[model samples]
Target chain A: MSITKRIIPCLDVDNGRVVKGVKFVDIKDAGDPVEVAKRYNDQGADEITFLDITASSSNRKTILNVVEDVASQVFIPLTVGGGISSVKDIRALLNSGADKITINTAAIKNPDLISEASNAVGNQCIVVAIDAKRKANSPNGISWEIYTHGGRNSTGIDALEWAQNMELRGAGELLVTSMDKDGTKQGFDLELMKAINDKVNIPTIASGGVGTLEDLYDGIEKGKADAVLAASIFHFGTYSIKEAKEYLSKKGINVRNTYD
Target chain B: MNIIAIIDYGMSNLSSVEKATKYVAPNDSVVVTSSPREIDNADKVIFPGQGAAKNCMESIYDKNLDKIIKKNSKEKPFLGICMGMQVLMSYSEENSGTNCLDIFEGKVKKFKTRKDTKIKIPHMGWNKVSKKNDHPIWYKIKDESYFYFVHSYFIDPIDKSTVIGETKYGDIFSSVIARDNIVAIQGHPEKSSDTGLQFLKNFIGI
Candidate 1:
């Protein structure tokens, strides 16, 4: 059996600074991305995801230097996403020591990109990211639509179906974020997450709406997600990785127990 | 001088183990070496491993550390971790044809669970270890102290008396096994926190 229940800390990098906000509002620069990533790595984060939120729109270099700087400091896996569209971009990220590359809007624009990227990099190195928002009026009744362009554009593509297709295209994992619940701190969208997880055999990492430790637990236990990704709670030091892991261990969630 | 020689068998997280040993046994000498001679001369030996069990055993054999480890076990303190602990068993069902160190008369078997259960494989993360006997290795640790574990196969001790600790997944399994001077833990003591650190300290004293 593969290793499951990963505790990930998402770094939303803007202008090379780590920033996070509630509901994507009042975005505040957290700290240096390398420094913050080092802190999480020292604290025992299972994996680190660096999402360059500004890379796509600004066309700025995805901070390969910063990725290299952080990767050199830690031994755990590092994943980079945002503005990663082509196989070349994936190559650049991998060359910089990124263990995985997450493709979001590019995957939505050209579904075949998944197959191309997977063919170039191993399937284990390619991750498909789905930014989903709940829709009430779909024919299926309460459907999840794919949002692209950094959650600015909504493509009517059903998230559940897209996830299944991406897996078939050889995506090793799926990073699913609920647009409605992102940065809300309320919790993860369990219904939408379960919808995708039930259909795909690959690992699904639930993103957005993580306010507290309970919210993360819900994403793993109730949402049935293989991993839970959070930003604000971890960014502000509201909860340490050790604390969250201890809480999960007490709940019988099979978390890495480092505590005495 | 209580020199702690951590076996460097090309496994993951060896640095972390060295760091943790340093943290616990600050004044004592802690060195990670693949040399069997160094291991033989060390006051204590720690066998830490990750990745596959068969691969780990092959590494020990390739480096000719098997005889050294077996010989040292009779005279020095030893601790095996994760796949390290699994490899101490007689054989593993992992590769089907590979034989383990056979130090302990037991087989490393895969976790048996029902299909409908939500339990995932590779049982990653922290869990509590129930004491089978109040061994000195667990000194300063409570009855059910939590320790970090990441593996799929577990040792089924043929000599239950050697089992020092047990942890429950879907079922209760051997977490730590000790026979005479050889003490092997299935969890990563370096990654594991205070209790794990204290356990390492106690092993050093032994």
Candidate 2:
């Protein structure tokens, strides 16, 4: 009766190889992005997100080729992020059949790029990714601060204020990643997700720190995320998307439930 | 070979729709064009719109593709998606108030998100479409199948008979409508996985 919470499997592709984030035990040639994408898509993943971690321009072509190949075979929504800086890059991905593209650094450095890209492409296809870390010693006593350069640098910008600003500047959705719990295999920062959800009217995706199926449930239940994005749990073959969806469904959460 | 014209007013990104159509009906020639003549000669038309209804109407009027679209809907197996479906209505409450194509009698209004429910705007992601009537487009597809949706406003058609599928978000709203030769949906049949590809295949068959 209501909109189902989305389960997105994050693929960290580097120079066209599914290198570090995911570790599919069953599939042959696990490094291939196209093969891994098909595995997830067949398993009834609500959506697929590819983070192009390649550093060189020539190497970025590998990610683009991966998107094109998978896009032809996979019928669900595909989102690509990481190192997407300009409107041209956004258009290139969209033209290659990427349903949505997420931007993190560009969103903060050039805030106007959000509005420009939102106007160029519909806000529906534009996603603003926020990386936040809890403040250690707060003079003002705020909970978290937005980080840039993949949690390497501090912006001193409050996460809540940045989220609201992005929404006002025309971001359709917010992808909130907790830098503190990113790879810890701990649970998500429920307070951070809940706090961002309360401040923004747009859909917020809870990312980082997902250890088990229970973490996925808490992301929606207590964290209040519209969708849950996990990297290692899905990529490392800890739990299939179907099992995650089934667990969520059995707990009375509305998921697609179309997977047999 | 029948030609399928995917209407592009330069408002929405048409690559996925165009790609899906070409993939499903490879034998048929699919063209994404704003040319009125190309649209008129096509056997079927797919009208895909996004962003705002006001801008959609303005672009259509600017390029003079409105007349051709209106003519094609009545003469071919027409499909409208998202904002494409919204603009088929008589008027829309989006952008304060904007006139639509008036092909179908309805009013498009914004989603009223209640603060308590935490229901977000721009209803983005997949939801179920419950069938209300036996339309050919429902061929082989089960009732209440999930389809992809992304929009802020919902449509309220005057003629209830035209509504073929309904979906619930904050409230139940019309998701699919069928009348004459026109078949329009608020969801994207192109991006909804296997079921979606089947939908396009069925439309191509029609």
Candidate 3:
């Protein structure tokens, strides 16, 4: 009836291998990016995000190889994050078959990177990934502050204001991860998601800390995110993308039916 | 089994489309190029693009692909996608109103945005597209099947008969248009998973 909220499966990659436990059967290699991605694709994942956790620059090729492998077989949008600093890096990833590239610390270091990259390649391919951590107490009515280096450091940037600025810089989408809720399984930072969604017109992907399928549904319902990204739930085979969509669809969330 | 040319007017990342097309039709020669000669010689031509309408049109002109596109749409099987589909319209309100290729008498209008409604701009995500008028592209694709869509604007064709498919955000809008040898889809079939792959397969077959 209307646009279905996207359900994206996040794959954490290190040295070209999927680092998380993908409990899907028939997967010959646990670390093979293609195998894991193909499994997600078969399960009806709307899109796949590959985050290279490796800080080693040499291992960058491994991620590129992984991207090329999955992209050749996976007939869905592919988003790559981590180490996307320069325009050349973005070009390389896109050439290697990434549909979109996410820039985080680099963009914060140089805000112009968002503008330059979006100008070079359409904004649709440039996603500004923001890791937000709640700033204890604020008199200014601020909810979250941006974090960097995998949530290891804080940038002291207001999440909402930065979101608006990124949108102004022509970011196609925002992938906001709540450091507070992430890995806690407590659910997404709904307050942060809603704030970003309300401030910017571009699409926002709600991520970090999804313990249950109900959390994903609430992300769209309460957070009002255009898409939801989760790892442990889908990665561990605890739930499939099809199951997730069916759950959301049943809740009047308007999700795509994984299997037509 | 065929030489498929994906028209690259510098408006898109043509890899996904080219890869999807190649995955579906491995035997076919799928090349992403702005060269008019390649488009002219191909058995099937796919017009896939994204970005502003004005920029896309300007790129098409810069590449001198307008004549080839116009010629192929009439004589050969052609499938236009997203911005590609938009450019085929008579005009667009984007960029403070811009002129298009005018293959069909239509205008691309932006979706209304309000502070109160949950409806977001760009209409970004998968949505159900119902068949308005049946065609080969709908071969095995069921009516109201879900497809990927991510755009702020949509086309309004003057001739409703040409609108083969429709989707609703706040109101019903044309999602697919077809006339003669040309079919334009507002959604990205390449990124659309199985349903989209099937649609592209049908286009390749045609």
Candidate 4:
């Protein structure tokens, strides 16, 4: 059967606390990771993602502890990312109760890490996160280029080409974040999403830029994303996951009936 | 006292299944154990698995769990999930072909997505499961209600009567199958939110 579109809340964690920022900088502390996760769980969030934005060696253990704490409380699927460079990191996070591990910077540096981790674990548990921004003028005329290190550096890798390579390398899912749309809250980069969604054979999660309920709708209906991942919208109390589901359901989007 | 033993063959992180079972039926003793005696003696057994079928079968065979599962499924209430459900079939095309538990007459085939088709493999996300028959497990979960699924292969049962629920991806496939004391689903009910908890509650109550 066809899958219903998902609405996920992405919590950027730094030093064991939930944080958010604009284009991966100017971070703002949101609240306790466990509390926010539990609330999202109660609100019927389709899934939750814990992104360790700190990307620091000292904060690595704290993030794992945070994952354990949140995993114990949340019943839905949990994905942990940030600073996951090797198969060992993937194993540690999965052991700590994360359902999936997202690899970003490490994957760009060493694309084979995607296949290595997927082979060690199942492809279903491996998520390759691609951060990109629209490139207007390029040698190859590619519309987007991959950005890494929290969107601070451009890798010059064609976004579409990288997405195809990740899928070929056995990535179960793709988390595509549009750096231009991050923290803007305007809407998702529909063009970028459509480009990757049309080519990739695995589910692609559209991240960044979700301001209104309609943006979430467009992410799936127009952008063709299997799941919509947002950060500030759900974290800052602008809207609830339940509200988003109700809104999507009203627009004829197949959403889980969370009627308690 | 209802003792629900979730057979742990080291194929899955049974913590979520145990936690959900406990949440649904607090009075019941939900144990995640590979002990054959515990599984055989329990009032009900929950068989949950994930990952590749080849690796899953290897672990099951290593622990000689297939025999225990087959023997217990006929006598007590049994629930299989994801890979746990697939292994109940006759065979799987995964891992260059692997023989399954042969409890059901069916074959597990991988999704064949054509180049022009937009259907994605691994079918990861939430989808509606249309109920075909009235069962205790369908208690609060409405017909065609959305449930989470993440799998590339699906079961094609020979006996259509055994299928209690069906879902549509590229083609319609059996998402939920039931016969006598056994109930199995392709979706992970533990990961499915509240409606899934209700499904577990129905199984526990039954």
- Estimate the Cα RMSD of every predicted model relative to the unseen true structure: 6.8, 1.5, 1.6, 3.5
lDDT of 3 by residue, A190-249 (tens): 999999988998899999999999999889899988899999998788888888888887
Q: Candidate 4 overall Cα lDDT vs. reference?
A: 0.87
**In each prediction, how many residue pairs overlap at the backbone (N, C-alpha, C within less than 3 A)?**
7, 1, 0, 4
Ranking by DockQ: 2, 3, 4, 1
Of the candidates numbered 3 and 4, which has the greater DockQ value? Answer: 3
**Residue B171 CA error for candidate 1 (Å)?**
1.1
- Residue-by-residue lDDT tens digits, candidate 1, A1-260: 22337799888887666766322123333366666765676676777898887745554464677676665545456789888878888877776657678998888788899998776555667788899998878785778889887688978888888988998897878899999999789999999888887887667899989998999899989899988998878777788887888888788786654344
For model 3, residues B1-206, the per-residue Cα lDDT tens digits are 78999998888778888889999999888898888888889999999988888899899899888888999999899999999999999999999999999999989999996555556666877889989997999998988998888788999999999999999887789999999999999999988888999999999999
Error of 1 at B197 (Å): 2.2
Cα lDDT for residue B51, model 1? 62
Give the better candidate number (3 or 4) by TM-score: 3
Give the DockQ of candidate 1.
0.07
lDDT of 4 by residue, A190-231 (tens): 999999998888999999889999999999999999899988
lDDT per residue as tens, model 4, B66-143: 899999999999999999999999999999999999999999999988756557889888888999998888987788
Compose the digit string of candidate 1's lDDT tens values, residues B62-126.
88888887888788788888777888888889877569889999889987656755454446555
Query: TM-score of predicted model 1?
Result: 0.69
Q: What is the lDDT of candidate 2?
A: 0.90
Tens digit of per-residue lDDT, candidate 2, span B76-167: 99999888999999999988899999999989988887765557889998999999999889999998899999999999999999999999
Q: Worst lDDT window (10 residues) for model 2 chain B? A: B112-121
Q: What are the clashing pairs of model 1?
A: A23-A183, A255-B125, A255-B126, A256-B125, A256-B126, A257-B126, A258-B193
Candidate 1 segments whose C-alpha is farther than 4 A from its true place: A1-176, A196-205, A212-221, A237-260, B115-117
Model 4 chain B TM at 0.97
